[model samples]
Target: MIINGVSVGPYQLGWRLQELEEKISISGFVEEELDKHYTITTNTLKFWVEKEQGEITQITVFGEYEGKFLGKIGVGNRLSDLNDLDIKWIKEDYVYKLPDYPGICFELEDIDDWDELLAPIEFISIYCS
Candidate 1:
């Protein structure tokens, strides 16, 4: 998977829900509609799409997703891994965002130890700002 500021793989922000359904079908994944969003799942990946006015506003990926964020970061990567990039992460609750990449956030594993550099990323989210 390829995740950027605006998209996760082929799932771009602002895409219609119908477009997602078609892509999901073509990818051979299963989609389940929750009260507020749709969950897409496969053997190795799980993600959710939240839509407003029929267009996707957010995409979150978690649970064994074996893809990199911007082809560099992903689950299992420690917070320290971003140090070389000189990113000043904006911390909010348990989520961290690169100052320059406002549309993407990484959720770390331990909420109680949010500042631990060794903390591995648990998931990633992309959204429209």
Candidate 2:
């Protein structure tokens, strides 16, 4: 999917972090840990980038913006909403996993005392490594 006009995924492996910052308007900072990480954020969306040896190792996204994740079906939506789009999802634990897109998932949030037949997305995650 596209984030700020830059395509991201396993294909984006090896892309430089500077390239993303220049291409996208999102704001973030690099953090030091076992591996270096850059976190980009909008009001509701967060993009995580991991680098090892100065090259991108993985990218992940999380948020609820415009009822989509990276412009694909995810977040800010109910589980039933995807039915209209004819997308397949698997519920495991509290996350809805998309089989069509590997390494992509949406976490569910409880809005009421009891779990509704339809659940709202709390966040979406796209893992690329």
Using TM-score as the measure, the top candidate is 1
Pairs in clash, predicted candidate 2: none
- Which model scores highest in lDDT? 1
Instruction: Put down candidate 1 lDDT per residue, 1-129, tens digits, no spaces.
Output: 645457777678877767776877755777788888777776544555664466777677777777787677888887788886666687888678887777888888876756668878887887777
Across residues 1-129, which tens digit of lDDT does each residue of candidate 2 receive? 533223343225456767656645545444444436666555554555665545454444445344444355555577677777777889888777777656666777777765533767777665551
TM-score of each: 0.77, 0.60
Alpha carbon lDDT of residue 75, candidate 2? 56
Residue 5's lDDT within candidate 2 is 25
Name every residue pair that clashes in candidate 1.
none
| Per-model C-alpha RMSD | 3.0, 4.7
